[model samples]
Target chain A: MSDLPENLKYAKTHEWAKLESDNVVRVGITEFAQAELGDLVFIELPKVGRVVKADEQCAVVESVKTASDLFSPVSGEIVSVNEELSDAPEQVNDDAYDAWLFCVKADNPAELDTLLDASAYGQLIAE
Target chain B: MASYSTVSLPTVTTIHKTALYELHIELGAKMVPFADYQMPLQYSKGIIHEHLHCRNQASLFDISHMGQCSLKGSSAAIGLEKLTPAIISRLGSGRQQYTVLTNSDGGIIDDIVVTRLGQELTIVVNAACKEKDFKHLRKQLSNDCQLQELSEHALLALQGPSSSHVLQQVAPEACRLQFMQACRTEIDDIPCMISRSGYTGEDGFEISLPNRFAEKMARILLNFPEVEPAGLGARDTLRLEAGLSLYGHELDEKTTPIEAGLSWLIKNTHQSYPGAGTLLNQMQNGTEIQRVGLLVEAKMPVRENAPVFDNEDKLVGRVTSGSFSPSLGRPIALALIDTEAAVIGATLFTRVRNNLIKLTVCDLPFVPHRYHRS
Candidate 1:
């Protein structure tokens, strides 16, 4: 029931990626991921311009009862981070699709095909 | 496949299962062993969702592992009065009050809920100490009254601000009842005892039904748009936010009701009860440590058993229960601190892991109670 756009790619860990201009990919958690971790109270975002590999922990979202790690979907150099989430992390829970966590310049654009497409990611979560 | 050498493993203790075990599994709950019961710690919707859901709407909780029993016959009230400090004889029908079971030396055995149901008195004890409570009750009470354990029944709690509305949709009669009142009713054709009482400090009800009909009743209740199945993890956080006491942490054999600040439950008119004299002595001379509420001034929570210190760095007491109160948007705790440091505005410190978190003694029930007293 999450808003999984067909044009986007997703990681098995639940992060979503949308390719932007200039080889930059905008990354954020899926709606399903935010719903699974309700009422987010705190978020620890990675510094901007930091290099991160695929599956690396890029952020932390602490809910009322538990804390969860936000993983990076592709190897990239962080170009810009969502500084707004530092003050109001619940914006992610309110609208996960629109609240981008960060933007990264991928080392290789071909890495996008290595991630699961919208339909495949939906099928994976259905299981 | 080659035969493998057998390794010895620790024997698993017999854990009590709830009536909604199948439903919990179907919802993908994370089961954990707690107090000899296989209880759900959290569900697939997760603890934060469940906790917030209970505060905003109604959440169904399976608390059937708690012990339920009835004391019957003519002399039941007088017999029970002899064991505990609560004035049971003064209680009328449909009245519920908190009381404690005390040992011979005036120490607490366990805290329990006592309800007067017509001629018989119904009691709910902690699950871990039910056996000990039963054995003590047997020895103290006269043979005129019979003690009957209702272990075959399952207890369900539907709690939140909207619980009354959700329950009223199915059973209209429940809407007329005030808080702490109990009545026999039918839900989806299953006869049950519904009490307008809960631990969440919200307007809610606790229903006791036959074990076989528990799942059906749960399904019927969950059918309400506002109701969701919550687990034990949220239950603990909610209770702590309400400033309610847990058995092993707040109440135990070494502590008395007076020290736990539960002297309100003990009636001075109850002349012949055990622990009355001891409580009177403590009231006059005062106890060493007193339980008080603390508001932590930090983001990280200070969990149980955290050492409490004064501004001068002297150890005063320890935290019994601590958690990030979902309703209050800050971490809070209940600690038993030195009587001198129990002032409402007294500054204190709780050592969480390696850091000394600043705390201040404050009023209880971090969130305002929403119980429908009327």
Candidate 2:
């Protein structure tokens, strides 16, 4: 079984989101995504105030093998980002869920209900 | 004498395998199709581990899939000179030169390693370009020149700081050879040609032997505690960090050796080859774009074909090859930029996906070459 934190929510694209408040949340990629990408050589994140649509490619994660897009799980305006990744992107490989890529002020907090729970995300990755 | 089988990617049914294919499978290598052959990309430890290990100690690589050919006879030297403008005629026996095969337009067809051994000239060409390279050699050379493709032989590279010490254990003569020099010798009774040259920046040897002894030789070398078998994944990163150009990525049919910053490869030959006219023109007027190494500022690696922009946001060039350097602990890249923007320390920007990233022109070989000079 893969590590899927039961307290958080996941997207099919492999991003994990944790609700910080009723209208705000923090987002990062899951361990599975980082492992699949291999040694994180580069990470491109959205700017703090950018509005991203759900499922839009708002960032990129590059590995030695290839580059993968980071899709937003919900519509939101970015509030903060992990600046540490600018120098050490491999932190995502160290602990993906803890190294939150960005924080967002959600436009619709209700959309969180549509995301996969830890159990559903676990089953999805298994496939 | 050909044994290479380049398989079509659509199906996995008929991929060619090297002599060490079974050994790689037993070691848990993840095999993938490369230049028509099923080669290992990585093993159980993955690419990063293999890459870092090669730098720290010594790593053994199976490069037998590369094409090997021999040109002999009294006219061999002149015949090969007609194909490339390198100093082959004056190239003394036992000397090896890194040269290029050019078309009539001065564009690079393929980058090759030519070594003068006894009366025959041994050539190592890229795996993907081997078939065409051999065909071109046969067609272009005069009848006096005999071209024999040595496809039945296997090539192995043992690279790193400890390579000399480990290899010297089996054959003491190997340690006496200098960088870019080759010598024919027997390693544990396996007849081989060992060259103290490699794609990796580290000091190493590339040994070629007949097919029957290849697997036996690899097993003997791997028996050493300091030598670990590395896959193609580590091979790519090591070469990129060393600033060596891949034939297809950093060279192509439309690009010249001049643009690739390989002017040194062209010797002053009075005789004209295929691209001599165009090469002379470029030498006089300078090239439109030049290849330069980049030190990517952030963690983002600028992958192949990513457009590069100057500080003014004008598109100046594109990255030919880019990757994070395990040795330098920073992202390093090779880009083909306008000649004006290729100055060292010049700043540039490139897009990795949708985000803009910063890069600066710097010296090649993110890691200094530690070749054994003596």
C-alpha lDDT (0 to 100) for residue A49 of candidate 1:
83
Residue-level lDDT for A37 in candidate 2 = 74
* lDDT, candidate 1, B1-374, per-residue tens: 23483875567578879888989899888787877989888887767678889999999999998999999999999899888888888888887877898875567898888888799899988889888999989888999999999989999999999998998788888777788888778987999888889888889999988899999999998888899999988998888888888989888888888888887876767757776788878877889888899999877667678899999999999999887777777778999889999999888997753557899999887777789975
Chain B TM-scores, listed for every candidate in order, come to 0.94, 0.95
Question: Would candidate 2 be rated incorrect, acceptable, medium or high by CAPRI criteria?
Answer: medium
Candidate 2, residues A1-127, lDDT tens digits: the string is 5668999999999999998875787899998888777778777888889998888888888887888888888899988999999778879988888898988888998788899999999999898
Which runs in model 2 stand beyond 4 Å of their true positions?
Answer: A1-10, A16-27, A48-51, A76-84, A95-127, B1-14, B353-356
Question: Whose TM-score is greatest here?
Answer: 2
Query: For residue B348, what is the lDDT in candidate 1?
Result: 93
True contacts kept of 2: 0.50
DockQ of candidate model 2: 0.50
| Model 1: CA > 4 A from native | A1-127, B1-12
- State the DockQ of every prediction: 0.26, 0.50
